[model samples]
Target: MSFMIPSAIKISSQFDAGNIEVLDLTNPQDIQLSIRKDNQSDFFQWFHFRVQGAANQPLTLRVLNAGQAAYVDGWPDYRAVASYDRETWFRVDTAYEADTGELVIQHTPAQNSIYFAYFAPYTWEQHLDLIAQAQQSALCEVHDIGTTLDGYDLNLLKISKPTESEAPAKKQIWVTARQHPGETMAEWCAEGFIARLLDEDDALAQSILEQAEFYVVPNMNPDGSIRGHLRTNACGANLNREWETPTAERSPEVLAVRSLMQQTGVDLFLDLHGDEALPCNFIAGQEGAPHLPDTILAQEDRFKQDLAQINPDFQLERGYPPGKFGPETFTIAAFWVGREFNCPSMTLEMPFKDYDNRPDADFGWSPERSIKLGESMLYPIHQWLQADL
Candidate 1:
């Protein structure tokens, strides 16, 4: 027998083994792991652990702690990622046993060391690398949108128009991610979008650069992400909720972004995020915004219909309930961006749970799908630019 060490799984640097409370691994066939907060319930979801001395063996992982977690329903149809090299991640079979709140992940390793995560993780180091790449591109401009309270740069990458002649009609399109820092998949999707946009061979990207300017903020809440917080900033503020009347004290991130939108006069805005509870990929728009003209509504409808046609991953059905106008909290996405800018803006939500239409038992809602969805977004957005705004 070949001797192999299985000490390969490493959680994203933001989270620690302290944050991960391993409940039981008595069953070699079913190793159990759990997440932990300092004083909270046993409930956990984000998990990263290593397996040593188990080469060429069929390893089964059972993650216990989903029962009391925030979105327990998500686990039933989820799959986890495993990587022997930490670069190429593939899906493994995961089964959520409802009776005991256990998530069962089964994998046969050819090599001893393998890493696993909820999805292919886009770590902070990778974010820095992305920023470096964007800064080097000839057509790209990179800068700090602002600094988070914890002093992390809210990086903004701008890809300008390739030619001076195309300036007059060129529109500004904004895509931002990680409002909820736990949604690491959003960043991966953003990375894919940015990479595709910068590629010279990309026809859609070429068209977009000629007709529109792209502004991307790949990490909106670096503080929260580094802190391992679920849905809030370093100050415990939910950045998504502070859109309408964002103040510096409560949400400087929103304040900076809103100011930028005002300065640039946004033609399009997409806030990328992952849904903890939802099981589908969909765009939530400002359907009930007060005084939104029929023309704009038609444009929005066309955008959705066109996107659904292009990609099987995105659907118009199974999204949040419509909120009436002037309701500050409920109408955040629809009310503020649409009514204020009079531009097409949307909250594009991916699922923490599996895509109900096409479920993967091994890798539920993986990063590959998220990146593909991001690519699909370009088509619908291009449609919006070509026809409406």
Candidate 2:
């Protein structure tokens, strides 16, 4: 009698922002796994990996700790994204076992190798390419502030109207994103923002630049980003929590950016992020920061309303409830900058899920939409600052 050996099914996550702790792989029908917690922090939810040798084979991969993830609310109504060619990703069948805290993904790949991720991934190579493209514009000045824990460059970009004088009078507007690394939509949004700001024909962008000098940090945690970790640096420190007491050893990324912020005073600061559970794009203010000014609050309200008019993707209806922050000692970027510098600061959050107000079942919340949102923000930001004028 001749017996055929079952072909081996292979799973790999050994790339940028890749994470999945394999437990049992003997049975494709009952493959078991758990997500690895971010280094030095307790955040875990992001996952991206490739599965091979299982073309046309039915398989079920289970994450044992789905309920214990950083955002359990994200699992429900969330369909995992999968791609064969990497250029386009679509929703795949996923089920969450609430009682067991397990996320079960069932798929049959038509290709030899396919990627599955919580959301579409934004890789380090794409990030560098974005920077290189933006650098070609005469208005941009790229600066490698310092070295990250993993030895990657911490890039910061300054974009403003080209002036003949050594120094031009303009309000210093700071926009930084991707502090958590896993919130990759932040950088994509920044890409749209930078592209529009550097456009020669845009009258609104020109008007914004006339009054503002932009300091933009496209990625704050290259160490965490390149390592495929969800929310921590190489040493397991969350960059957002390090803003208040950043150290050279633990959080050089924050330390370096903060130093540069001090060198150039900030008039308005925008820190972008992504919320796993949310289905809309929204902004969080420094409501709990010390010395609360009525003007800043008014500006926040005005910007929120005005932005909704500009972009239908942005809504104030569904978002994080504010007033959860604290004093100047707080480590968050928006709150810290607001309290220390008396400047209006905000945290813009994009969703991993689709926008409930305007859903796209196929692509869900995507990089293209994120970039459009970023482009929409320039006009409102320019208009809001007019209150000061």
TM-score per candidate: 0.84, 0.94
lDDT of 1 by residue, 1-389 (tens): 89975554422233422134555555657666776532222224555545655677777777777677767867765777777876777777888889998778898778766676665666677789989987787778997778888887888898975667634678888888988777878888887788878877888888878889988889888876765555667777777778877788768888898888888877777888887768888877777666778877787778889989998888887887766234564326435777777877778888877788998775678878888877778888778877843
Tell me the lDDT of model 2 at 348: 95
Which residue runs does candidate 2 get wrong by more than 4 Å? 1-6, 164-168, 326-329
List per-prediction Cα lDDT, in the order shown. Answer: 0.74, 0.87
Model 2, global lDDT: 0.87
Cα lDDT tens digits for candidate 2, 1-389 = 99996678888998877888889999989999888888877888888888988899898999999999998998888888899987688888899999999999999899878999887888999889989999998889998899987789989898977665765577888999899988888988998999999998998998888788899999998888877777888999888888889999999998998898899988899999998887889988876555679888778778888889999999988766656654433688888888778878889999988888899888888888999999998978988768778
- Of the candidates shown, which would achieve the greatest TM-score relative to the real structure? 2
Q: Could you give me the TM-score of model 1 versus the true structure?
A: 0.84
> How well does model 1 score by local distance difference test?
0.74
The candidate that achieves the highest lDDT relative to the unseen native structure: 2
Query: For residue 236, what is the lDDT in candidate 2?
Result: 92
